[model samples]
Target: MAEITLVEAVNQALAREMSDNKNVLVLGEDVGIDGGVFRATAGLLDKFGDERVLDTPLSETLIGGVSIGMAAQGLIPVAEIQFMGFACSTIDQILNHAARIRNRTRGRLTCPMVLRAPFGGGIRAPEHHSESTEALFAHIPGLRVVIPSSPERAYGLLLASIRNPDPVVFLEPKRIYRLVKQEVPDNGEALPLDVCFIIRPGNDVTIVTWGAMTHDSLVAADKLAEQGISAEVIDVATLKPLDIETISVSVEKTGRCVIVHEAPLSGGWGAEISARLAEHNLFNLLAPIKRVTGYDTVMPLFRLEDQYMPSTDRIVGAVNEVLKFE
Candidate 1:
């Protein structure tokens, strides 16, 4: 029950799984000797030895191919891409082989692999270091895209992803990796996948978000509370196979909805959620759905990072806009 940050919680989950399951192997660039670029895999190599914790070449394609090969042959591989921006290089293997293996083999085989990467902007990282292109994987059929906003969720969701019998893209928000800490129990309990968690209960508006945006959304909720506005916050932990029912139910009660994300506005996952609400819960809304999101441009460098990312002011403003519909 030690207090740990999101990154440490991730390390705890990997260690627990690797210790409990001998077939679980960790592979990625600088994962072994270097303990990963963020040190999420720190100390794993020494505890599990080189055979279990392997250090691969700095090639995302090779890492994807090798993990898929290992998974098909009965080994459960948890592969890590150095950064979300670099994950595009491995999309071919992921979209083709890894995602289609179960259907291609007609249930004879399952791809139990977890692809982990740190994503989003805020840490003043250089180009190709910060990317929130989660929508790409979420659009792909048969792939489960999961993002955790807190240390507790990171621990549980990651364990669940590795145990899942399908390919899963586990994106970690690096900005919040060590921003907060929580006393997460190291009991090896895996949380449910494809579900949304209600972070706060309210009746005025439903605020939907995931990953690092959850932090700002919660902060906005608090600010709105001071002004006598009740905002319900929903953390869409499992982006793929989205739990729209949970969101729909919340929107029904709140009568207003505001979606938020760090990804650009055009094709962010927030659009899909907005579309679903309109399709199934159109009559229940009191106002048009609003989305507070990043601009449709490349993530800027350190100087402009703060402006590029959505802030509490934007979220509160969206809530206020929706509340005016009545």
Candidate 2:
């Protein structure tokens, strides 16, 4: 095992998958010779050659459509959209076609494709490069929305996404792409999808989050620990088809919950988790569920990015508020 950044782990997974399975191919703008805008696909072209590592035109719609066609025809296509903000053009193909193919064909065909995009704010990126609208895709049926928080999860989950028999939206938190390093094995093994990973265990409160927010939640958990607050931190790696059982069980133990995310508060996935808790574990709550999320507004420019995203302070504050009830 070698220590690597989240983005490097992603590149390793892609390389391993493409090497292990001839059916897996990478296609996207600047993915080949240029090795991708962020170099997540770096060195792939040299290892896999031009045939497997294709550089498509600068049209996300075309990329989405071609990927759908390839997946329906038995190829496992891993298409990359430079940024989540630019993926709007590919929504038609993803929602209407790629996602609905299997159900529409009544099992005659399956769309085994992974749409990769770097999402979230930070890195001083301009507009159209720092969006975190994952909930939009999570709302769509027949799609698995997966986000990785750490290098190990990035490596394992990405491999699982590519091998999934259905279409998946693999969102990478660019904010933490190189923020931290962790040891990840290059064993070609895939982690289970639609599951949550508990980062820290405690009995005081459950803090649920994913992507870049997970880092802040962990930090807040540690800080709260110093103040005698035992916070249980959970990384909801798979946003869609959420592993509600894990979350509900944790909340049931703590009897308090705080949901966090970088996406705006309105209609974010945090609300979905809250709803699940309210429905299934209403009696388990010792306090009202609190949400520490970004404001319900457009992600601001880099200058105010910190104010817009949920921070360690915000998470700890939310936990304090919930703890107050008891």
* lDDT score, candidate 1, position 314: 95
Clash pairs of candidate 2? none
Residue runs of model 2 more than 4 Å from their true location after superposition: none
Model 2 accuracy (lDDT, Cα): 0.95
Positional deviation of 137 in candidate 2, in angstroms? 0.5
RMSD per candidate (Å) reads 0.7, 0.7
Local accuracy by lDDT, each model: 0.95, 0.95
What is the TM-score of each predicted model, taking all chains together?
0.99, 0.99
Give a tens-digit lDDT track for model 2, residues 224-316. 999999999999999998999999999989999999999999899999999999998899899999999889888899999999999899999
| Residue clash pairs of candidate 1 | none
